[model samples]
Target: MRKVFITGTDTGVGKTLISSLLVKKFNAYYFKPIQTGSKEERDVNIVKNLTGLNGEYFLPEVYLLKEPLSPHLAAKRENKKIELKKIFCPQKEPLVVEGAGGVFVPLNENSFMLDLMQKFSLPVLVVARSTLGTINHTLLTLEALRQKKIDILGVILNGPLNLENKNAIEYYGKVKVLAEIPKLKTINSMGIEELLTNFNI
Candidate 1:
């Protein structure tokens, strides 16, 4: 199966927005491996609403925890343990898997978001905020992926355009800046279209 694992430098850096855009553009299946706080918010629903895709294109999460904390903590609160074996990609092509929070986020005591991506053996598309603190966050993220010897597709700079941050990330991290998305006041198709104009999927 063909897949692209979407991760961010930090939580709320717009991973979902990029994932949703890719899903909409490719009409690909979306999967969130370990989802916490499903009761409060669901990434699947967000993708559905954003992409306007049918339910079949969105897969149910492997682990669904109640609390909004990290997967490890959230699973502990529910008295459940996450097994990496339980997290498997669908036997289908053109799937876009969205990771929970940043790359180092814990899926269990030993496993992290990076481990999951490694297991999938797919190219990673990192979403980074184009604001302050992004240089360290993004470069560190790139370094982590490099240490693991994983394939990096590219980085997507989200939010307002910052040339310095963009150039620095590309040069220092030795990774291409695939795209940049403008800060959105809305998230409908038209707004998404404008934000995506900087680059294509």
Candidate 2:
């Protein structure tokens, strides 16, 4: 795929970790359009350290809100407005863009993260936590994407390996289980590179 838009079922659902993995495997340009919480550890920082790729590999975020909240609220907190026209996708191939949260996450008063994905027109690579309650979360995420008529490339299960959850997601969602990512005690090139075997890239 030329582009892979990484999104999660919820916050802390391994979007950045998976994004960094895809960046390493594909040697793709990593971009997180809007980022919240600039004072603490940002996703870009984590991705940079994990992927071990610097220089042109990372792209600057469009919106950098100071609060660690939803884009809409985060922008609101700063008395700023998130204009869709401001978020532009770089004309780079093999790009891997990560969303802040689930597909339905609010970006502005009327727009959501899904709206941004629609604008990018890239196949979604759903990153879900591999644990209890993932079935419902994955299915609901798939359903939302379906309703939006967005193409879902596949699902990536992160955390412990759970066969039952994986089977349920594939059978019920009718989407391919692209890969299952186990929790890594340490994020390094060697370990991260090994997990890439489960993916086609």
Candidate 3:
């Protein structure tokens, strides 16, 4: 199975958006390792809405946290510890693992999102905004992935408005831009079917 880790340059960079689309495209199982904020605001709901892949696809041990802060701080406030083992369980099909916030976001006092990714041992698919300053963030994220010896399965640049940002990321980062998704687009099953057809997934 083709398991992939989905992370973003920062929060609100559409990691859930791209991850849901990927789950539909590849017909893969979706897993959100750790989700903070309320249950309604979690990415698993969005993924379920988009893919209609049944409850089996969404794997999250701790569903809701009161605060929308980083997982570590939120867990601390709630007197809970983020369990890494629960997040690294095996899935029957290809798994699309979504990370909270950015690559370096803390999950505990000594562990971050990168540490979780390393534990999972999944290839990464970076979802970055297609705007100014994206190049810097993307590059830094790429370097972090490299340092951790994580396999990067290219990038998916969200919000396809800035051609310049896209060009810079491709030129400097030297990674394939797998897909450039525009903002405010409705990607249903049909759209996902088309993407799978095109990519021969």
Candidate 4:
């Protein structure tokens, strides 16, 4: 089965949004290794509402820390450690694995989100903002993935429509801008479907 690990240049950059769209398009299983803002099931709930995809599959971490902080710090505050092995139990379908925060965000003392990506041995789909400063962030993220020898499926640029950065990303970054999603005041399943079609998901 084909699997793609979805991550972002930073938090709130639309990793979840893109992941949900991919899952809906490909009818793939979804997994969130470590979530910190809400209950583990809450991530699945939001994705379900956003994608309108039904299945008996959705896996999140067992320790759902309430703090909206990095996983490592949240786990520390809760007096727990995130076991890497827990993130990689075998699944039966094609998967879209969502990562928390940026590539280097710590999940524990020695492991970061990228480490989890490595653990899964899945190609990455980077979700980035379409606004200012995205070029630097996107390039750096791509470089990091290159350093790790991770296969990058490409990047999805999210936010208000902006052609300048889009061209710059395509030209300078030397990576395909797989899709560009317009800023949405509210999101629905059809909207998600539109974005997926753009990406050929």
Candidate 5:
């Protein structure tokens, strides 16, 4: 088993859902270092509820900003700042960690999500949309990770299966199409288990 950092081509790209899948697949702990958004929509809670996992399987977020904005602006709104030094992984192995938005999302004035990804140095699994515009977004994300010399586990396509987009991403991005998760009528542990059988990490 290997620890993985989950990032997305953009916000609302189903990172949390994929994170829950990985956590369930590996029986691993889930950690979201910095979370921005209202308390009601916390990623940890969502993962726990979706997977029916307990608190032991989830780690507390370092920064839980109330505003649903970019991390830097959200922290500023609350009169605080995000520091990379304060974020660290628990001793648990094969943990699944997720990022806020895209790779370039700002964490602070000087540091972006890319900086934190580098700090962790975990192999990355990028979650991407399985629709139009994904080619550009997914390719750019892969390229950025490559330039940083980050080890990419590959990309996961979420939504209705689009063969063209999947082939384009695999060919142009030069990365494996690890899995294609369809839009489930009900997103729960059962759904995740079904998807697990469809693809291997």
Candidate 6:
């Protein structure tokens, strides 16, 4: 059972893509505890499409906010409070959990995504971009995770391979570079399956 929480440096940094890859790699259930988006824009649907997996591999989100904003704000708009106590990992093992944004994003007025990561207490694998300005974003993310005493598996650089960025992240952050995924011409199950070969997670 290889369970990991996949977070990113920020939103749209390929967290869902990495989650899909890991779900396929380990044949694990994909769980995104809090999703803040419209009904049609769910990441779980995208993951299910990419992995071409059945419903059993997916778990229902605890909070599915209709607004596409941060968890706290989205929940507020709906007049709902995001409670930590209501969240529980499924009985299924080898799960791949994904956070709703960057680690610092607030889940409520007081708690942050970092707190959710702590609640899950699973090892994290950060999905970062392989481009300019990534060094700073990645280092800060790593520091925050360390501050919470979270176990980090390493980083997965999503995008074109940039040796400079990769070396800097590994050297300065003192974290391993698990994989470097280049841009894909076509994103589907076949592409995801092929890309899984290059991953070391």
lDDT of 1: 0.89
Model 3 lDDT tens row, 61-148: 4435768899999888899888776665465578888889999998887888999889988889999998888999999999999999
- Model 5 steric clash total: 0
lDDT at 173, model 2: 99
Compare the candidates by lDDT and give the number of the best one: 5
Instruction: Please give the lDDT score at residue 158 for candidate 6.
Output: 91
For each candidate, give its TM-score against the true structure: 0.96, 0.95, 0.88, 0.91, 0.96, 0.96
Any idea how many clashes model 2 has? 0
- Ten contiguous residues with the weakest lDDT in model 4: 54-63
The whole-model lDDT of each prediction reads 0.89, 0.89, 0.81, 0.82, 0.92, 0.91
**Tens digit of lDDT per residue, candidate 5, span 110-138?**
99999999999999999999999999999
Which of the predicted structures, 2 or 5, would earn the higher lDDT when compared with the native? 5
Answer with 3 or 4, whichever has the higher lDDT: 4
Stretches of candidate 5 off by over 4 Å are none
Candidate 2 lDDT tens digits, 1-201? 588899999999999888988888888889999999877767888888878887598999999888988889999999999888888888897899999989888988789999998888889999999999999999999999988899999999999999999999999999999988889987777777777865554
Candidate 2 Cα misplacement greater than 4 A, ranges: 197-201
Model 1 misplaced stretches (Cα beyond 4 Å):
196-198
lDDT of 6 by residue, 130-197 (tens): 98889999999999999999999999999998999999999999999989989889889998988877
Write down the TM-score for model 1. Answer: 0.96
Would you list the rank order by lDDT, best first?
5, 6, 1, 2, 4, 3
lDDT of 1 by residue, 10-94 (tens): 9999999999889888889999988998889998998898878899998998898889999999999999998888889888679
| Residue 164's lDDT in candidate 5 | 98
lDDT for each residue of candidate 4 in 24-139, tens digit (9 for 90 to 100): 87787888868897843457677888877775657655557778899999899889998787767346578888888899999898999888888888889899999999999998
